[model samples]
Target: MQEEFISSKQNAKVKNWRKLKTAKGRKQQGLYMIEGEHLIEEAVRSGVYLEAIILNETYEGAYPTGFSTYRLAAHVFESLAETDSPQGILAILGAQSRFNAAEDFQQLLAKPGDAINRWLLVDGVQDPGNLGTIIRTADAAGYRGVVLGTGTVDLYNDKVLRSTQGSHWHIEVVELPIETAMQTLQGAGIPVLATALHREARDYRTLDYAAGAPLALVVGNEGQGVQAKLIEQANLSVFIPMPGQAESLNVAVATGILLFAL
Candidate 1:
């Protein structure tokens, strides 16, 4: 394994690593940074391809072997960290292959009849926390995967990654257009259900999800809810019936309820 000590914040490698904090940088470089020992351990446990393991000069913890390691000066590590209380350990990894929309979508479609069971389709969920929570919930609920539709926040965003608490490493997540995802699932005989409050919508509890058919649940933006066009394209629309007086549930909370119930 290669090891290096970098004290200069102006080092070319440090500059490149700092770029990973932005969407454009991550896209351009096809790499993203994850700080904290838990995240690094999760990545290692998941057998993710690690480009390098980075440590604050003072970090004393042991990390996995057989990978390149870098030790950064205190100031340099602080400047690269996203969290106020940064964990002394971090990792750099290649972006997951599933982020390629077209290829991953085709692979989902190619699944042998009903092999794709449950999926969470996210549409324009702007909040990183909400999106991350949804993904984590989906993983816990035994869903097949998550398809992030158009306008959804980037899955690699640091807040989203942090909010997931390492669940992202445990499940399959892909990006695709909402319409395309709906059509593909429907074409494969799976029912697509959109969460919305409309005249035609049914109570979520009333739905028959135990019929052994594959299912896909669509949750949308925190404010706008699911897009009108996507809702229309769905096989059905479902809404949670609140007994108490409240406008609506948070997208993440609603998703947990629906995932567990269905």
Candidate 2:
């Protein structure tokens, strides 16, 4: 490995790391930082392009071959890393397409009608961690794709990427207007189900998973729950039952349980 060690924190690339701290930089530069062998390897296997592979000076081992490689002083690498205890490697990957339901959700938008089914829609789900975890769980359960609505968290945020644990790459994420999403699914004979916190809501487990038709699972904002209009549009309204003392399951946890149950 050809190592380039820099002592000055002001080095342009180091400053570039700071830019990644904001959503704008990530969007404009079309890059995001991910550290650790496991995460990078997952990205690599998914064929996500690496803008650069930056490593600590003392690093050793035959790593993958495909991109620029730089070795900063171990201390410098540690200083720039988002987490404690640097893992001796970091990678800059060009920005990936995130799930936006309204305008740019390519997977479903481009596919033939037969390919459009089993979507997971979100409305104003602002928490990055929660959104990412939901995508991860949905992928594990073999859903078709995700439709992200207005006010949802940035899908490419580092926190979301980390929370997804690599599932982000496997599924499709589209940003779309909620109305467009509903219309798209409804036109294709896919039924929409919105989760609710109300008393009369059907228990999630009791829903007919075998409806055998394409289904869309709609999860709403954290505090506001699903919007009233969405509830009115859904073919079914459901909720997770709780025998425990907690008021409700966190959005991601509840979604996972429901995904598995259905």
Candidate 3:
């Protein structure tokens, strides 16, 4: 089908894109805006429905004709896009698959199977940028999937989607309460790994990752790391071996290292 190109900012669809730019708007619409070429491409592959795709007049992207698209004037796209240097191609995609802790856990158990299903669990990582980058890195390192505990960033938030750069489509991100998640993983016989600052965390590399037991690598908040209750619940505490003078690696980077190592 030939895409119906839209150049006016007043178009109904464009107005919705504007709303998706804000956090409140995304929550209200149950959708989000993705502002770059690569991110949109990745989201599409991840099975997200592209309600509409907008492109700057200057960009020429290769996409299947089956997906609806709009070609906006360069000025209009720049006005709506959030990137520092907007690439001119943007899209508004449907949100990730929502999960009720009770329902989804049973399904995910199979994905991170017997041979040490390496997984990343996020507990209250609020900033969208950090969450998105962490998700993206998790995808690259081939972690079986991710679990989001309470207080974590909105997976469908536009900023998180942008930061993921399309990695969202590749991994399973399950959001649920910390306690519920712990029970499910434990019931399935998977070991849970927690990252802590000054506690019982052993060196990261020393863990035997190749053993193929189900594993969940948990990262905590920016200020407090993992919560006390959750930390105590962990089966293992592994610290990222930081030899430099710096205090710590950003949570996303730390997540990436642990994921890749596993």
Best model number under lDDT: 1
Give lDDT tens digits, candidate 3, residues 217-255: 789998788898888898988888767899878888888
lDDT of 2 by residue, 123-204 (tens): 9999999998999998888776788888889887777888888887787777786767987777667788999877768987
Quote each prediction's TM-score.
0.95, 0.88, 0.86
Give the Cα error of residue 251 in candidate 2, in Å: 1.0
| Cα lDDT computed for each candidate against the true fold | 0.88, 0.79, 0.77
Which regions of candidate 3 deviate over 4 angstroms?
2-8, 45-47, 58-63, 110-116
Instruction: Assess candidate 2 and give its TM-score to the true structure.
Output: 0.88
Runs with alpha carbons beyond 4 Å of true place in candidate 1:
99-104, 112-116
By descending TM-score, how would the candidates be arranged? 1, 2, 3
Q: Model 1: per-residue lDDT, tens digit, 82-185?
A: 99888788899999877555656766666654224788999999999999999999988878789998899999999999889888877778888988888878
Top model number, TM-score? 1
Runs of candidate 2 with Cα error greater than 4 angstroms are: 98-116
Determine which window of 10 residues in candidate 3 has minimal summed lDDT.
110-119
Clashing pairs in 1: none
Ranking by lDDT: 1, 2, 3
